[model samples]
Target: MDSPFTSKLGTNYCPTAEDAVEIQAFLAQPLRQMECLDRKIAELQHALNKLLEEREGLGSIVQSHEALLSPIRRMPADMMQEIFLACLPTHRNCVMDAREAPLLLGRICSAWRALSLATPRLWASLHIVDRGEPPQRTGCGRCPSMARTGWSVPTIPFAAI
Candidate 1:
């Protein structure tokens, strides 16, 4: 029962060989336990890595299924066509601007583009203005904020007219 710290005047008593042997045995048990714990930690780390890989694989599968679940993909072609027709801009004159409604619809996706092009009604609405005609001065959208946002109405090219 000797304390860890001792004064210089304290007895420097040494234990017997039997006592030393018992202490060594006591320390060996804990050493073996520590080795067992280390093995378990390694096994758990490997298991965690495997679980993460499994989760990633499942996530990709889920994402693909979710893409298929999209409402737009499920819409009937006739209904979708009606919706596309409904999206046409009402105020446009006979100008051919790419950023305009009918043209912009084609830029969306291959499905919408095919639908837009196939639907003669959408193209038939185009009103061609003469190149000599002046543009609407009121709609210049020359406000500093509008110009900064790059949202100004795109003008139809004179050559395309």
Candidate 2:
């Protein structure tokens, strides 16, 4: 672009009315171009945000579908039962805490909960820490059959000590 002013632009230079008008006109084109570019950038940023949200939704669906194909989900009920039994403490009876095997196993999923509840051996032994409130019924609530009929594995034996 050619200079609109005849003299070189410096700190000491003072603009006349003509020079001021010319300066405004010279800056107008570039300023409008900058405003147009800003609008375009905002539109692109909005589009990018929408695309990112769609990607997140698709990713969540993929993860949930993948969980259905897990190897543990395919294992036979008997094998899962043995795995649950193995998770029990050998030295002492299982506690009521949700962190340990018997309680934790049931909390895993609906299939595991059904398996754990059906397998009486998992509820065979329990260490009840009485807080010195009146004793409730002495039966395993997890397995209603065991609680009512007292049907459990003879080898493991039920204990509430």
Candidate 3:
């Protein structure tokens, strides 16, 4: 069998000892590197084809052009009010801690923002039950008198209602 180096150099041109050693070292490295590169390329191509096939199968469920908005301009006002009321606290003294969540909801779009701000009842109920026992007299929440009175606020306090 003809070696690669033999074919590259004419038979009359014999390599010096140093040249032979350099050529052997260079060839040995590239053979291992080429094998590693070929294996990695095959693995990547296989993964790419699998992803392409999966994406093609999703159809309208994954369609990029689908509209994000509701088909209607407005839902009935009474229904909206009922939904908001459903979220209200059933007991007195419950403070609505939903301020952050509602603000985030409103930020999604102009209509949602307007609706969230317009609905006062939605922000009315807060569950003081989650606030834990009234802290001892030393220091606690902003309502020091509330802790001193030992009068637990109901889910929706009368003052808030």
TM-score of 3: 0.35
Better of 1 and 3 by lDDT: 1
Highest lDDT against the true fold, candidate: 2
C-alpha lDDT of residue 62 in model 1: 100
The better-scoring model by TM-score among 1 and 2 is 2
Q: Report model 2's TM-score to 2 decimal places.
A: 0.68
List the lowest-lDDT window of 10 residues for candidate 2. Answer: 141-150
Off by over 4 Å in 1: 1-53, 94-100, 127-161
Candidate 2's residue-wise lDDT over 66-132, tens digit each? 9999998889999998999999998887776799988899898898888888888887776555444
Ranking by TM-score: 2, 1, 3
33-79 per-residue lDDT for model 1 (tens digits): 99999999999999999999999999999999998899998888888
Writing each residue's lDDT as its tens digit, candidate 3 over 26-120 gives: 68877998999999999999999998888787755556444444453467766755654564445543343435343344565687656655665
Each candidate's TM vs. the true structure? 0.42, 0.68, 0.35
Give residue 131's error in model 3 in angstroms. 12
